[model samples]
Target: MAGKILISGGSGLIGTRLSEMLIDQGYEVAHLSRDPDKFSHYKTFRWDIQNSSIDENAITYADYIIHLAGAGLAEEKWTKERKREILRSRVDSTQLLLDGLRQHEHHVKGFVSASAIGIYGNSGDQLMSEESSYGEDFMAEVCKAWEAAVWQIKDLGIRTVILRTGIALSDKGGALPQMARPVKLMAGAPLGSGKQYMSWIHIDDLCRLYIRAIEDTTFAGVYNAVAPHPVTNQEFTEALAEAMHKPLVLPKVPSFALNLMLGEMSDVVLSGQRVSANKVLQTGFTFEYNYLDEALESFYKKHQN
Candidate 1:
């Protein structure tokens, strides 16, 4: 028998890919969206996260719920208002789902949600694991609250897994495309000091991790969803340039410039912390694209064709 799945943020990059992948794997998928007319594969329900009004039917018939709703961290400057939106987008959405699960008649077996490495902050040369201390930054606060909200579902006796994801690489709407754009134009440059470690994973691997979390009953707690090998910002740029068959000639973007342009959000660009996917791997999950260069090549080839 196929499992029934409910997904929030089904229209976003990771959510869309994960929904399609689940459907292909023979799961019945439903999506909760602010707008329901966008996709045909899944039943879309209206939900205002702030008001906590979710379609009751959407909550009543699921075996699993994957929450990936959030504002794009890099979509705008980290002004006071934008920061509130970012935090509210995640917390409110998760709260809505939790309320539905508590108030509605759903037999949800498990909960899977998206998290980030930003919670660890700038770790310099230190290696971060799931047990590492949370960073004292805006992103860290957001992640802390975001994860806390989802943790509420666990209290309801639902199996829960939080994916503390790293930068997801893909040609389909992510940091990769923006990075690729400059490289394809032969003007690619490393960002900041180029020493910041970028913990990254292929989009395919990320989607599979979520699937594994749902299918594998024993999987619970936090798992760092990153590739085995973490590369520095310089290495990422070079690999991207190589994949595009372009020369890396430009100097690195200065940290000060990024700070000036991005404001508080510059932390995302100028600083990075290395994260390990050891916990996820220990669960017997295998990565299809574990290396940075290999993943970039595959992505570039797909884009070209």
Candidate 2:
């Protein structure tokens, strides 16, 4: 085993897989959760963000920490209350971790946080890099504040790395499963204009990046965690249909219908930016699946049985 690693929101789609990958690589993994008992296999520590409380041992037992706690952005309609929860769940939980670190004298080595490409908003076909301008939308603001909270860890003299992740494609549970369903049933089509670029990464590659952040001392600052090649929604749909051996015959899903059904969340699917992987690649990081077709094929091949 290597160093002890603690993850906040370690039960989510990315975190669950990350914890397993870290374990398989001989690093001990633990989780920060509201209910510790729910995760019997791992050492679980409790943290109630609204209450401003975190388990003391969680801080003391970790050599490194990865923060991935956040409310689902597209799970429901964006009401005033829901917006507050979406923002607070990420910002406040991070603040709670900082608070926990302050209460105890700890020697944590590094902090890796998960940010999102939503910060770029609906950039159409514009190529987005880490230094790109921030979008002036609800989700953009949420991501901005989320990263701002993570930046506070740098003051403690710990090297912090922030990854502005794009759409994470995993067969287990993520955008891929949802996107693949209608295609499998032969109803898949382009969403909206289908020109909005989706910068995405395979789950296995993303887990490798997280592992790299922990092991590589120079992996600091912000990097866009996406594959080198980005694709349009139409291209993505076509590739997926090809991967599953299904034919794409349906017309493009209209923007108006999607807007009516998804409300503000429709923007998540209908709008996207072509995010760059140059920064991470410059750091010598490589992707296992760099092309959209290959990534979709890999996922479908594993689950076709």
Candidate 3:
């Protein structure tokens, strides 16, 4: 029989691509969503992560469970209530799945979970690796809790892998498009000091990293899902402007202005840490687009006329 994979958050950007990629690779793919009707994929199922209710039948006889469900960190203002929801969505949904795994005690081949490089906090100039210490920030706290929740699966003797994802670059509903919008209008410029590192991965490479983790038995523990080359915010903005054939003479948004506009959410915009993908590369995963320019070019070709 072909491998059966269960995916949470399959409706989101990365999950949608990953589900399609897995199907193309001849794996049996099932996705967990709050509303299955929104997606036309035949493999989708309903699961209310907020209520801790999951369709247990979906995982029966499955070979792997790739959990990608979570509240989008950058989706809304970081109000106190919204922050709680963000953390609970990831941690609770993960616990719900672990509960099901424990109840079934089935020998699932692996449990792959989504994490973020935000756990490293705002490392000014340091290039972060898996061994780097967690930073002292709200996002770092959330990631720490998120990973801790997934760690429960280990007690069941199931192989669990956590992907500490970086900023994902794609034209379709990702950070790139939002950033590109301002630049396309000739009002686009860098954020903050423009010195903060933006460790990012092409959407294609990120999906492949998840697949590699699920299939490769030797892949355990955490891997940074970022491109081999990380660029500064200034470099990223300039490259994006060049790709869109726009002039890059606009002034950057100062950090104080961003904070005034976005409140706590400004941290995500004004601060970034460089992350290394060497571990994933060491495992023989090749990135299709390693450089920011190449990645931006592909996005422009696809989305820009």
Clashing residue pair totals per candidate (backbone < 3 A): 0, 0, 0
Error of 2 at 21 (Å): 0.5
> Global lDDT of each model?
0.90, 0.91, 0.89
Could you give candidate 3's per-residue lDDT for residues 153-232 as a string of tens digits? 98888998999999998788879888988888899989999999999999999999999998899999999999999999
Candidate 2 lDDT at 222 equals 94
lDDT of 2 by residue, 1-305 (tens): 39999998789999999999999999999999898878467899999999989989999999999999998876779889999999999999999988878779997999999999999998987888899999999889999999999889888888999989999999988798889889989999999988889999998899899999989999989989999999999999999999998999899999999999988888889888899999999989988899988888887877567
lDDT of 1 at 39: 54
Runs of candidate 3 exceeding 4 Å displacement: 37-39, 303-305
Q: Is candidate 1 or candidate 3 better by TM-score?
A: 1
lDDT value, residue 92 of candidate 1:
92
Query: What TM-score quantifies how close candidate 3 is to the native fold?
Result: 0.96
